[model samples]
Target: MERDRNLMRDILLTLALILAIDAVVVGVFALLAYPWLTFVHAPIAAVVGTTAAPVARWLVVFLPVLALFVWAQLRFTRQELLADVPAGDATRDTHPDLHARFVRLCKQADMQPPDLAVVDRDVPNSFAVGGVTNATVVVSEGLRDALSDDELDAVLAHELAHVKNRDATVMTLASFLPALVSDDRKILNVDGGANLLVWFVLTFVLYLLASPSLPGALFSVSSVVGFVTLVAISVLGGGIILGVLTAPVVLLSRRLSESREFVADRAGAVLVGDPSALVTALEKLSDRGFELPDTDARTHYTGVDGLCFLPYGLDDTDASTDEDTFTVETRSHPPTHERVANLRALVDEL
Candidate 1:
């Protein structure tokens, strides 16, 4: 019952956050575009011999902004999110056992199997991306080696739970707005975020020349320079201002993300009918990323932390070489102990 409540709460929260961030995006565009509406519609007005309605100007401005957002959302998650993570596709020919296990689990869960990406590392971690219908689950080589069959099934089921709930898609889509303001996320998810800014400036300038709002000239010296400067400030300055507005939503994401992680943990447990297996799996793999055989553990940890099953590698080690476990509220995942505790509680309920 508690798990169900958390699941529903997270679903609602995810939707609310998406709507909130989108609202902020539209609001920012409206604010920036309103000042230039006269220049935007002046050319069209002259062509038709009558001024366009005020709403017409906004519609003209909003259409492109909306289009850009939709395009960015799809391109960002599908292409850029996995651009940095090193993983190869898992095929039944190459990974017969793992592929079979995934297929069986999905059948039990009454969902289709998603594509799998295998990372050739000793780190035991996995995460899902995209939606239920179009999802990819990533697994580290070390993960299969570290856990027992049941435990591996538990971990895979956890990722499958994320796919089933569509939290992975929600999280990826949710990152779009926050990524605009976040440098760390930009590095991973957004290859060149200026697509919107570039498109916005292009549309704004094109209309400026399509028909002149002022009588002198499109390139008039004194007044033209001032008008150009205003346009620059309105468009460029809006980005800086919108970044400030999104800061609060970014903070809100921390809590909502943590909730979703917990829900995935519980849901993954329910999916497999073995909450204790997940608990054991998480505890055994807690030491992941330490003494990693490949790249810098810290960099890789933070790089995939958002999409990883656990935030195991995102922490610092103490002098004794133990994970610090220290975390800030801004972190997208809850602490390891908290996840284990939640799972343990679910076990008790069963």
Candidate 2:
């Protein structure tokens, strides 16, 4: 019954967050469209001496933005998949036993077996990547070395749960708008150089279109003031717009991520019929003091810290300080103690 309740909660939370992210993306589109509608298109229409319907103008603006959004989604998805593939030296092709174990686990979980790889890192971590058909499960060398056979099976089950749930795809889709806005901001900045040359050209074209009707010289005081004001508004308004659209989506994504972790834990525990093994795995992974090498640490943290069995570098204990409390609250995974307790309760019920 508790499992069912958690399953329901996960469904509800996932739906809510997905809807929230959709709304945010739509809101950003509307915000972006307004400037084109009121400023750019209006001026263009005036110059053309034709009044286009508001709906038509909105559609014109919306189509391109929608195209870009789709493109970004595809681009990010591909990048994530590529990122999941092990480097040349990190491949686990020689480990047929591990591969067979993963295949067996997938059969038990009723999920298609994901491609598997082993990272050379000693971080004792694992993560899942890719969409449903192309998903891959990556485990660290340190993790395989650290855990017992049952514990390793439990960890694999956990990663398989992520693949089965399609969490990576869901997360990527949820993060689409944030990524787009961030990347667009970089493109809009002058410092982006050759990469944003097309944007600069577009800006130049707009300037040409707007300048013809103005009375003052291009560098006149009035023109300078107008340009500065426009820049200020773009900076401030863009910040506000991005913040409003991003904050809720990001927060909700994080919440959904945490909820998914719980669901995965439950699902993985059931898959193995050994919640205690998962509990032991989580405890071992949590308490392991292995530090990632400096060269790989940043990439590891950004890539798979959230997907790991436990929060990286954090002990399976209650937060002792105010800062520690904040860190626990903000972490992608739930506190280890809570997760262990939950698994223990689940084991008891089983």
Candidate 3:
């Protein structure tokens, strides 16, 4: 009950944060593109200082547009991926049995059936993408060949839990803010930043030119301080805006992802009614070395790798060291050893 409540809280928080970030992104875009809508008819105030009203007004108009875009993108992208890659032949080898068992598990969890795809790649991997019932569950052929029925069911249930929880879409939406902030940084550098730097330098030159003519030291000091303060505020404000805009989205995404992985692991175990089988699968997969052909070192492993049954690829500790968790950071999936340890602990608890 506690776990379920926490999950509910996380889901609500995730939705709220996504919606907030969506609004912020739209507002920022509109403020950038249409300055007049937000502009106030204050000629005297404008002459003295630029008002923030125009920026505020632009945000009000952009929120709905951005929300629609996010929904449409997630909806259509899932359909396209599913259409291009038809469901794997359940009749092919053990996949059919795996599919039947997975369906049973989904039903037990009260989830609508998710589309499943099998990849012929050598890596032992599986990923769940999409939201609600429109989810896609993908597994590499290597994964099917590597585990027993119960173990496979556990893995599929884990992936299905991801679908039931709508984790993929949440993560994608969460990531949008960071991407937007990063892009906004570029825009500020190109537009706001460049202009400010030019003005600051020009103002310094002008002050120096007029410095000799000032009648008092107080006037000179005040002039220099005022100019420097203006430049400082511009840079600081832009950076603050960028950080404030992205932090909630990123943090919420991470929190939801972490929680969902744990929930999925438990749900998967229950789905097969065999926590030990899931444990066995995790142990086996941990021993099997895996690597993606072209994935970058920074690729997110998260839940996808958290349930894998083995370590993959050649035993080269020095291959990739950029991951936050130095052990499993080499590939898309998290480190097999750590995952195995965690699962074993989870099994003991159950």
Give TM per candidate: 0.80, 0.74, 0.59
lDDT of 3 by residue, 277-324 (tens): 877877776556644434432244322332232323212233443444
RMSD of every candidate to native, in Å, equals 5.8, 6.3, 10.4
> Candidates' lDDT values, in order?
0.70, 0.65, 0.58
Cα RMSD, model 1 = 5.8
Indicate the TM-score of model 1: 0.80
- Model 1 spans > 4 angstroms off: 35-52, 131-133, 183-211, 288-302, 313-331
Report the Cα lDDT for residue 59, model 3.
43
Worst 10 residues of 2 by lDDT: 322-331
Supply every candidate's count of residue pairs whose N, Cα or C atoms clash at under 3 angstroms: 0, 0, 14
Residues 317-337 of candidate 2 have per-residue lDDT tens digits of 232333322121112666778
